[model samples]
Every structure is written in C-alpha cells, then in structure tokens.
Target: MIIKVENLTKVFKSYQRGNTFGEAVKSLFVRKPIYVHALKGISFNIEEGELVGFLGPNGAGKSTTLKILTGIMHPSGGKAEIMGYTPWKDRKKYVAKIGAVFGQKSQLLWDIPPVDAFYLNKAIYSIPERSFKKTLHKMVELLGVEELIKKPTRQLSLGERMKCEFIMAMLHKPKIVFLDEPTIGLDVIAKDKIREFILEMNRNGVTFILTTHDLDDIAHLAQRVIVVNHGEIVFDDSLTTLRNYLGVKKIISVSTMRPLPELRLPGIKITNRISDYKAELELDLSKYELNKFIALVNKSSTIMDLSVQDPEIEEVIKGLYH
Candidate 1:
C-alpha cells in the first residue's frame, strides 16, 4: 500500500456560548472548553496509482482527515503513513513528496502570473531546469492554459485559476495528491476539462485522493469511494459494488404510438403519465429483470420511444447517509 492509516483519530477543543446574557456574563470568568471528536478512528488503505473519492456530509470528519493526512494538523491518536513517512512528525521532508489543493485556498502568488509561481516552486522543490521545463510543458498542454498562465492570478476566472492551481500542485511531480472540491464552481466545460486532466494524470501513474461534494466527480473519476459520516467510515468499496449493494434500479420512460391503459406489475412503479400514450416507470432490478418487465410492457403498447437510466449518483450517496 502506498498509503496506510490505522485507527486514525482527531479531537478539537472549542467553547460554547451561554444561552442567556446573565449566564454568559457569569461564564466569562469561568469559561469551560468543550471537546469535539472530529475523527473517530477511521482507517483505510490505497494502493499506488489508485484514484479514490473521499466523501461525506458537512462536519463528517472529511476535512479533518485530510488535514491530518497532509500534516496540517496532528491527530489526538492513531497512526497514518504515506510513502513510509509520518506526516506531522516529518513535516518538511514528507511535504516534499506530496501535493495538496483545497478549493477555497491558493498556493500561487496573487500578484504574479502563474508561470512565475511555477518557477518559484521549481526553485523551492529543487527541481532540475530540464525536468521543470518538461513537466511544465506537459501540464500546460494537458490543461490548454498557455495564455492563462501569463495572466495575473487576480484577473483570472474561477475555472482558469483552478486549472493553474492544478499546475502549481503538480509541478513538483509529487507521488500523491490530495484535492478538496477541485471542481466546486466550474461549468460543464471546465469540469470536463479538469476531469480529463485527472484521468490523464492517473493513467500516467500519479495516485490521487479526491474529496468533493460533487457526485458527478466521483462518477466520472473515481473507481473506488470511501464514504464518511459522523466521524466514521460508513461505506468503502468500488462504485459498481456500491450500486449492486444498493440493489440497482432504473427509471424507464416510454412513449407509445397509441393510447395506453394503466399497466401494473410487481416491482414496477408508475411514476408519471405525460399523456395516455406516454408514461414513466421505475423498475427495481433486484425484484425483477428489466428485460422481462420491458417485454411485458411492449406487448400491451406499441413502444414509440424508450429510455433506461441508472439511479443518479447523488441518490446513491444520499442512500448511504440514511
């Protein structure tokens, strides 16, 4: 395993305000700090060159776990190792071999163009001149941001800045990269571009751990998903396994050539009726075969158009939380 975590946990101390003014005034002189268990001993492993999605609802220990793994914060307890290094204990040396990008944060100089920042990173990481040029050239081409790199950071759009952020993070060629909400505010085109770059990079053997609330990102980029809730790991498996485990279902919409009568079948739900000739039905595959159900429907009506769709990825993730 390139990354291994055993019983990792993190705790934080915070203070709660008094409910009433009188109590608040009295408590000021005798403030009591409350402890929050941000991470409750979560553990998982990732092999080299694997792309994994880290998912959770808000305040579910997702960010806490990432912070601990990246050495930005220390855990209250447990062990974590990435590439044979203890993140917090060997901070400087460990960071040299890893890269991270938080959607709300930036590593580039706000006043300078991204190319200048890249050079600064090259110097900081001690990257050779030849290696730096080769890597930068590839990244620039992959992202198609040659012009944007020359623009000042403050002037670039959100999507443009994000693309540059990826360049800065990968300039050093870190073994593992941690991305938090990398596509948070991007449009369809921008999101597709970023997703493509991620796929390309993964194919070239850079391991990635992505944390995002965007289910589409998981559907498009991650083969494996680890779901966290209330400071614990709730689900960890391949996307296919998750769909199967959740008892895969599909929504089928049909348009008939003639007026159709109300049809009823076991495990089939009539969701909507656009007209006498058009209707939508939900089919539970675990209860019955889709083809069997469709054939039965076809016998009764002349099917003009039909479409089948798997449950949305958002629905699947929401099911995990429930």
Candidate 2:
C-alpha cells in the first residue's frame, strides 16, 4: 500500500458569542465552548499507481483529511502512514516523496517568471541540475508551456498558470500527488490538457489523490472513489460501482420522424420533452431491457436519432448526500 489511514480524527475548539452588542461585549469574558469534529475516525487505504478521488459536500471533512495527510495539520487522533512514514511526525522527509496542487493556492512567486519558481523548488528539493532540466523540458513540452515559463507569472492567464503549477509539483518526481479542485476554472480545452497530463503521469506509475466539486474531473480522471460525508466514509468503491450504486440505468435521448407518443410505459420516466418529435427520458434497465425499448420506439415513431448514456455522476453523489 502507498497510503494507509486508520481511525483518523480531528477536533477543533471554538467559542460562541452573543448577537447583541452588549452581549458581545460581555461575551469576551464568558464564552461557551464549541467543539467541531471535522474528522470522525475515518479509515481507508490506497495502493501505488492508483488514481483515487476524494469527494464530499462542504464541511464534510475532506479538506481536513487532506491537510493531515499532507502534514499541514496534526490530527487530534488516529494514524496516517504514507509510504511508511507518519506525515505529521516525519514531515520534512515525508514531503519529499509527495507533491500537492490546490486550486485556490499558488506556489509560484507572483512577480517573477515561473522558471525562477521552478528553480527555487529544484533547490529546495535538492534535485540535480541535469535531472531538473530534463524533467522541466519534458513537462514544458507535454503541457506546451515552454513559451509561458519565461514570462512573469502574474501576466499569464489562469489556465497558463495552472499548467506551470503542475510542472512545479512534478519537478522532483514525487511518487504521489494530491490535487484539490485542480480544474476549478478553465475552458473545455484547458481542462482537457490538464487531464491528459494527469493521465500520462498516472500511467507512468505516479499515484494521484484528487478532491474536487467538478464531477467531470472525477469522471475523466479517477479509477476509484472515496466519498466522505459528516466526518465519515459513506462510500468507497470503483467508478463503475459508484455509477451503478442506485441501479442499472441509462439516459435515452431519442427524436422520432414524427411525434413522440406519451411515454407512460413501465420503467420509463420522461425527463424532458423537447418537442412533438423529440424527447429525453431515463431508462431503468433493471426493469426494462434496451432492445425492447428501442424496438417499441422504432415501430411506433420510426426513430430518427437516438443516444444512450450512463446516469450523471451528480445524481449518484446527491443521493448519497441526502
């Protein structure tokens, strides 16, 4: 196993004050304690070269878990062992074997060129000159950011800067990378480039742990998923299992040569009626077979066009949350 976490826990202590100004003034002397349990003994393991996604609603302890694993915060209880090292206890040594990219945070110096920041990381990690240049050029080519690296970081677009961020994290060739909302803001093209980089890296034996609200990222990049909610593990399984968690279902979008009939058949739920000739519906494959449904539509309306796809990942996650 590359990562092993057992009964990890975190408790934060805060104070509660009053609403009124007079009460607030007096509350400075007397305050009620509020203990927030951010993590409640969560446990899971990850194997090397596995790309896993961490998902949860807001205030679901996902960030807390990542912080503890990255050695930024000491846990209140339980244990996390990454590559056989306790992250908080062996931070200096442990961090060398890992890399992280947070969408809201920047590691690049704002005023200087990204190459300078890359060199700084190279120095901090004590990467050899030959190896550093070798890795840098390879990533620059892969991301097609060779032109942007020499320019001031602040001048680059969000998508451009994000590409540099990936290069910075990978320079040291860490075994595992932690990504939090890595594709938070970007167009279709940028998202695809970054995803391609992640896949290429993973194929070469690098492990990745991703946390994001963008289910598209999870769908495109992750092989397995671990969902945390209410400071606990609610679901952990393969992406295939997650898609089928509710049941075997497919979204059917069909347009008929003529008008579409009222789809009141068993196991059929009309989600959207585009027009008299077009309609979209959900198919409960467990209750109704695909062949029968297609045949029925063909005979009645003379199907002009059709599409079948898995249920949205959002639906599966939303069900778990509620």
Candidate 3:
C-alpha cells in the first residue's frame, strides 16, 4: 500500500462559542477544552502511484489531515502509514521519501535566487550529484522555470515563483508528493503548467495527494476525490459519481429577437430576464424534459443564440455544505 489510514483522528483544543463572561471566566479557571475532531476516524487506502484530490472548505480538517500524513503534525488517535512508515515516527526518514509543496507557505529564501534554495534542498536531502543534476534538469525543463530560477524569489511574479516552488519540490524525485493548493493564485497558463507537471510526475510513477479549493483542479485531474466536511469524510468517489449524486442541472441561456413576459415554465428556473431579448434559465436535467424545454423556448420568439452548461463543481460542493 502507498498510504493506509485507519480510524485516524486529530483533535485540536480550541474555543467554540465562548458565550458568557462567567463562562469565559470558568473556562479560564477550569480550562474548558473544546475538542476539534479534525479527522473523525477517517479511513482510506491509496494504491501505489495514484493521484487523489483531498477536498474541503476552510477549517474542514483537510490541512490537519495532510499535516499528519506528512509528519508535520501528530495524530491524536488511530493510525497512519505511508510507504510502511508511520508518518509521525521516524519523521526525518519518512519525509526524505516524500516531497511537499504548500501554496500558502514558501520554503525558498525570499531574497536569494531560487537555485540557491534548490541547492540547499539538494544538500539537505543528500541527493546524489548525478541524480540531482538529472532531476533538476528535467524539472526546470518541464516546468519552464529555467529563466525564473536565476532570479531572486521575491523578484519573480506569483506565477513564476510558483513554478520554481514546484521544481524545488520535485528536484529529489521522491516517490510521493503532497500538494496543498498548488495553483491557488496562479493565472490560467501558470495553473496549466502546474497541472501538466503533476500529470507528468504521476505518469512517472509518483503518487500524489492534493488539497485544493479550486474545484476545477479536482474536476480536471483527479479520478478519485476525497471530500471532507466539518472534520469528517463526507464523500470519497470518482468525479462522475459525485456529479451523478448531485444530478446534472444544466444552465441554458437563450437570446431572442424581442422582449417577452416572465413566463412560468415547469422544471425551468428563470434565473434572469433582461427585457424580452435575453433570458437565462437554470434547468434541472432530471426534472426537465430536454426537448419539451427547448420547444417551449423556441415557441417564445426567434432564437438568436443559446448555450447550455451544467452547474459547476464549485456550486455542487457549496450546495452540499449548505
């Protein structure tokens, strides 16, 4: 097994609804410890070389779970093993076999060239000189960060720095990689670069456990998605399964030659109506008869243009939480 987590739990002491002054006072005296069950007995097994997306909203224990897996934090209960090593035990040795890139945090020296940080990691990880050169060359070429690597991290743009970050993470060619919001602030091209790099690495037999707020990232890359909510695993399945469970609700926009009245149509939500010339409709695919809906709209006026799309993955996730 590449990763085996059984009944894993991480509890953090935090304050929840500290209401009364007397209650606060008592909390100070008795120290009312609120247990944040970050991972409530989460159990899953990731096979070798699989790329999986770990998804959750803010404070949903996604980061907490990753910290435990990477040996950055200790689990409060249960067990976790990555590549036959208990993540929290012998952390140094375990981590040497894994690479991590956390979007919110920077591991490179701000004022120095990115190559400096890359070399530092090379020395720290004790990579062989030949292997180091080979991997670094491949990463720089693949990520297209060769030009950016020579510049100080602080001088580079967000996207440029992100590319360097990715190269640094993979320089040692570790077997497993943990990426947290790898494309968080990147532009379209930068995001594409990171996505391509990830796919390339996975193709070369490296396992990846990714955490991100970008649903597009999950939709495009991950075949299997593990969704956590309120510190619990709410869903773990393929994107198709999740979409099927959510049902396919398509948004259709119709443009007419002239304006029309607000017509009450069955199984069609008139999300917006701008004069009689333009209207937007949110249609529930399961409920709406596709041809019937189309016919109804066609009868209204001469159709200028129309386009349809299912509700986005982000909308589906938000609905689940709500």
Model 1 residue 12 lDDT score: 91
Cα lDDT of model 1 by residue, 1-322, tens digit:
9999999988899987789998899788888889999899999999999999999999999999999999999999999999999999999999999998888998888999999999999999999999999999999999999899999998998899999999999999999999999999999999999999999999999999999999999999999999999999999999988776678789899998778766676778888988999988888987879888767767888788999998888878888899
Clashes of each: 0, 0, 2
lDDT agreement with native, every candidate = 0.91, 0.95, 0.86
> For candidate 3, which ten residues in a row score worst on lDDT?
258-267
TM-score of 1: 0.95
lDDT of 3 by residue, 1-322 (tens): 8899999988888765458988777777576558777778899999998999998889999999999999999989999888999989979899999999999899889999999999999999998999999988988998887788998889999988888888888888889999999899889988988898899889999999999999989987897999899878888988887776677788888888766546676667888886668888788777887777777667867678889877778877876676
Candidate 2: tens digits of C-alpha lDDT, residues 175-281: 99999899999889999999999999999999999999999999999999999999999999998999898888999999999788897988999999989999999
Model 1 ranges with Cα > 4 A deviation: 19-27
- Which predicted model would earn the best lDDT? 2
Q: Where in model 2 is the C-alpha error above 4 Å?
A: none
TM-scores for all candidates: the values are 0.95, 0.96, 0.91
Stronger candidate by lDDT (1 vs 2)? 2
Q: What would you estimate as the lDDT of candidate 1?
A: 0.91
- What ranges in model 3 sit over 4 Å off? 15-30, 258-263
Rank order (by TM-score, best first): 2, 1, 3
Candidates by lDDT, descending order: 2, 1, 3
Which candidate has the highest TM-score of all? 2
